[model samples]
Target: MSIFKPRRKMVVNREVQYDVLMYVGVFIVALFIVQVFTAYLFLDQVQRVVGTMSALEFIARYKISFLVYQIIPVSFSLIVGVYIFNRLTSRIAGPLFNMRRILQKARNGELETAEIKLRENDYFQEEINDINVILKRKSD
Candidate 1:
């Protein structure tokens, strides 16, 4: 499908892309830490209530349930989150990259051809539209 067509370049703005990715990475790490801590606390409470099993023994016995209930969900969420963030940052960064190129062309007295036409899904459409109007008047 047209929507699935690959772009010529995935990382048009390296700085923005990497920065957003780093933030997402940090968020995922924080989430993982919280999940592990919460699971530990829950397991600790269960062991105390049972008064027979050690925490490690409980974990070892119910390892499959732990994996099914906690690890799997977190891993799946991380995958989905990364995919969504990548798409969102691309939409933002692609337009910014195009705007910079259009500005460079305008600086070189190429205003007539320096139209700011971004992808339909890209951010800054309204801003680019306003800029294109100004460029049109200047070229005229």
Candidate 2:
């Protein structure tokens, strides 16, 4: 048997995953706005010090450079952040989802053949194991 089993689904809970992603999305948007504003202020200061280029001229000349240097890196970081958060949230959500189902089965007295089986890397193993022991005894 393979020691590692990949998760078939990226999302275990839609509400939870979307909520997390939404918060992250909001934060990223705010961060990007602040960064762009700061960059613009710095560029304006530089133009004043140089006293050669008008604001419009400076922006027109360096817009491509700003996109290349700033937007691309921020976009890449946001992509990576979303991926990492999705995986991290899935690890927590997957175990909770399983636990809820298993506990519900126990409550309904349909746990005779049920066991709380979790992935190797999953959280809450100890808690689930304790519940399993109690359910096994009750069924016995």
The best candidate in terms of lDDT: 1
Q: Which tens-of-lDDT digit does each residue in 1-140 have in candidate 2? A: 99999868777547556766786887688668767775776577556545687779877877776666667666766787777677767777788898889889888987676687888876566777887788778778
lDDT of 1: 0.76
Model 1 C-alpha lDDT per residue in residues 1-140, reported as the tens digit of each score: 57786757676557556867787887778678868775886577566545687778876877776666676667767787778788888888898898899889898986666788788787677778988888777777
User: Cα lDDT of all candidates, in order?
Assistant: 0.76, 0.74
lDDT, model 1, position 134:
82
TM-scores of all predicted structures: 0.57, 0.60
* Each candidate: RMSD: 10.6, 11.5
Clashing pairs in 1: none
